[model samples]
Target: MLPADTESESYRFYKSLNEDILLKPNEFNEWDMQFENGDVVNVTGYESLQNAICIAIMTRFKELKNPLYADFGCRIHELIKANKSRMVEYKIELFITEVLTNMRRVKKINWIKVTDNPNNEFFKYLVEFSVTSIYDKIVEGEVNL
Candidate 1:
């Protein structure tokens, strides 16, 4: 049996892609994803995508053109203006852009796809998207609203 070498090319490749701290909701948080303890778990590229999707879906951006500007929970019912689906799609693109602006891993948003869910009454829409890649690796995420 051969002992693994951390200096090996394969090991280094994996380390570069995987050696990152995973962030989580800590015991105490006020806003802006605050954590006094700075708690983190396993490192994962997919987790970043998942979190970004969640944040985008959960919040309504004050400025759709700007990043990191949002308020919790969009009033979808009342805010439905002319062209409901288009409005939702636009908002999602902006929200995803906002979240991924600071994320170093994801290069660009490939696309933001919004679809109708006829069966689900509570969530009439489903959002699907991909933020391209992190170090040549792809990650996908989704939201239902």
Candidate 2:
């Protein structure tokens, strides 16, 4: 097969994954991706693109369901909702730091220190910042700050 065909197949395989699994926030979301001929691959293969996007999102959700220490903080929402009483405040940053601490099995002070001056209100601001960063990073591959 031609080199282009091989590349096309590779794209198709990855693209098919999104379709079969239905991952959201699809490959069209990748700003860095470009086409020499200026034809967008993700937009062209629309149905499979949608599926691939959904699958990708579901995979991320699964990872969040049970995460490593670093990732647990990133997925605090899932954890708190799972065990509300265990999370005292249920505010976002509090939830993030708590879940991260539990996953690490570390003292709260350490996580707080890493988070920078972790007061309750300050932590709330940090939570908003982190969420915004995640969205920006995913959509544009650049965190706002």
Candidate 3:
């Protein structure tokens, strides 16, 4: 082992969890990850980082079905069915920060912004943000709340 903090922060942080279980958000909803074929998908690099970001933000804190993921989720679910307002926007931003700020793949959160869409009052929140990944690559992601 290298002594005294010789490893790069990205490598050190993402040493163990550099990839996530293949769960395509676009294809599946609510963690129901499945493919047409009975084959498992394994991914790494930026794609894994992207999936991790989405999973963290979409999950309700302590709401995961898996006990191992008891602590892997965002607290924004508390705002579900909440009235749209500035305070809600702020809280959304805060919650996103709290969740993504600590991810092993995230180097730094560039910015987080919440916008309202007047079309769907019940469930229409667009949360957008940018982050520097552990590989020193800037990746942009968004989550709908």
Give the better candidate number (1 or 2) by lDDT.
1
Across 14-113, the per-residue lDDT of candidate 1 in tens digits comes to 4433333333433332124423354433333455456654654455545364554544334333444535566666665565566655555566777677
TM-score of each: 0.47, 0.21, 0.73
Against the reference, the lDDT scores of all candidates come to 0.52, 0.30, 0.73
Question: What is candidate 3's lDDT per residue for 1-145, written digit by digit as tens?
Answer: 2122225463455544365456764522345454535555544556568778888888778887787777888888899878888899899999899988879778899988888883465557888889888668888877666
lDDT of 2 by residue, 1-145 (tens): 2123334553555332222222223333432333445443343123343232223222323364544523422433344334333233344345444443332112222222123223543322222211111112211111100
Each model's Cα RMSD? 9.0, 13.0, 7.0
TM-score of 3: 0.73
Which candidate ranks first by lDDT, i.e. highest? 3
* Candidate 3 residue-wise lDDT at 136: 80
lDDT of 1 at 106: 67
How many residue pairs of model 2 clash at the backbone? 11
lDDT over C-alpha atoms for residue 131 of model 1 = 71
Which ranges in model 1 have alpha carbons more than 4 Å from their true place?
Answer: 1-43, 56-85, 118-123
- In terms of TM-score, how similar is model 1 to the real structure? 0.47
